[model samples]
Target: MPAAGSGLYVGLMSGTSLDGIDAVLVDFSSGTPRLAASHHVPFADPVRAEALALCAPGADEIDRAARLSNALAQLYAEAVAATLARAGVPAAEVEAIGCHGQTVRHRPDAGYSVQLVNAALLAELAGVRVVADFRSRDLAAGGQGAPLVPAFHAAVFRDAREHRVVVNLGGIANVTDLPPLGTVRGFDTGPANILLDAWAARHLGEPFDRAGRWAASGSADEPLLCEMLADPYFAARPPKSTGRERFDLAWLERHGVATRRPQDVQATLAELTARTVAEAIARECPGAAAVCVCGGGARNDDLMARLARLAAPVKVTSTAALGVDPEWVEAMAFAWLARQALLGRPGNLPEATGARGPRVLGAIYPA
Candidate 1:
């Protein structure tokens, strides 16, 4: 595979929520890569605040964004160092690092999606070749350029006997439905933790409602939930994608019903996430035998309980039951993506992400 110079690599991801950075170590051997180790590094308070502020639309924000990007690259480098240390491996032993970067803006249909990461800075700091900006290439090829992890999901979690649905409830909720032994399909269902986390930060002065305890303490506003469910995105077909640009604080402020109790709004937002995801499954993958939930939303018991109610007959379980830690699945998926890039293999499923055809995703950067 490419003359045998490729060695180990690390993948870094900081999703829309600005929660933390997930770093994973990947070792490519015999053409397929194996996961060496993974680690999570929480964002410093000021950095997180700056990142969140940059996600929204505003003029004269590019300077702050540039600084934040450099800071993020340094943080990513530190995460790689810690992960490598935990695995007892040196950075010199690794080949390159694939960083998804923080997705500040993702608009595939407009032929661009900006993932804020400084790969050059990362390479300099980590002392390794760095592959970043994985989405724009696919968008240039007229693809949604999202749910990119489904290719990796198919590689690691596909089952032969049972048709399954893998749901990653990150800032936005996306699902990949794998048929028993054939093709796969996926798309963004709706908002996951973004709305909930933003509401918590505004109302409770916390980053998130841990285990959805705030939601559990209140009752769902049925009318509000119904109005949110009426959004056209939920009823649209697959191969679609969305981000904070469409479902952020401002959007919620304009569309979400104003209520007196903050807890009620929290409960409604949780319900909206669950209901939309369940509706997507029922409409798109009626034959799914089981649903495996992953990402940060899986930790929210209130959200999970509501999902269980919406998608009956299909057993709901966490990705942990299938040998993948829920918190690390997205980060680990990118590690697998790095391996696919090195192997010259297609990283997007045509049926899943609406790519014109199978295309090997990502580019190589020499160390």
Candidate 2:
């Protein structure tokens, strides 16, 4: 049997944001894995459009999703090649590729989550083993099958002397609470960039508000912000996971967002994310001494400032301060998950996912 954590691995992640694919080459020979190289490939306009459409129910869904999966597999393969080349490594040298396929629908309540990818095709194209469909096994084991990175977070970011919270601000925000001693837990805190990105694309014709500049230009509507916080998902307890299907543009419209000025609405959305995350820390991770944020949202100066103010007394900073680039943390996480799965080690944290117990995640597709 191959030794655990002894080789290079590639991780691919295309989050709910639909921003694009992030691929990373990580060397795991040492206790602290080194990020060898990373590459990002933005989704072409049509692909992004199709993917956004598929997030909701639509006509001829099966056929559309299947074709899109193939296209995404090709993209994943290309990303692997790019990242490996950047690291000056060969495909034969890597053990496997861990791919978190694009999430079109995640309804853990109904006991299913759909992440689109063609793992076999990816393995063949990349000439490396592929481990994917990571959530289903946890779901089968009666877990929410999400916030899977808490295990990885515990392995890497946990500090023994002080409690810390690691938040991944992707399309959706999730928090992992690492107490100095106790069961580590995590859950979705609510919308992060999912709504912000959609709102920006709709009004600004831009992919997202750079550094949340447009939002910073306006003020948050207090009433609107309060109403957004009333979302039931915000009140739901841990072991929960959510996605674009629950917090999309339609959600904004139903909450009377149309009447507000676009920039003010943007500001309100930013507040919603910041407040929810801060509140979650207060409620679930009390006494957290520090918070390290990783994901695209870390770059949003406006959002980061709001988070700092709201999560006061608890120092807030990006994961880069802790040695991992914020943009590539999630990609690196899946790489760690692949290593766990290949070694038959449990990847899902029982406390994090509310699973009956720890479970090995993903299906392996040999090269």
lDDT for each residue of candidate 1 in 135-206, tens digit (9 for 90 to 100): 866776788989898888777778888899999999999999888766788899989999999999988999
Best by lDDT: 2
Q: Enumerate residue pairs that collide in model 1.
A: none
Weakest ten-residue segment in model 2 by summed lDDT? 1-10
Q: What is the lDDT of residue 257 in candidate 1?
A: 54
* Global lDDT of each candidate: 0.84, 0.92
* Whole-model alpha-carbon lDDT for candidate 2: 0.92
Where does model 2 exceed 4 Å of error? 1-6
TM-scores of the candidates in the order shown:
0.95, 0.98
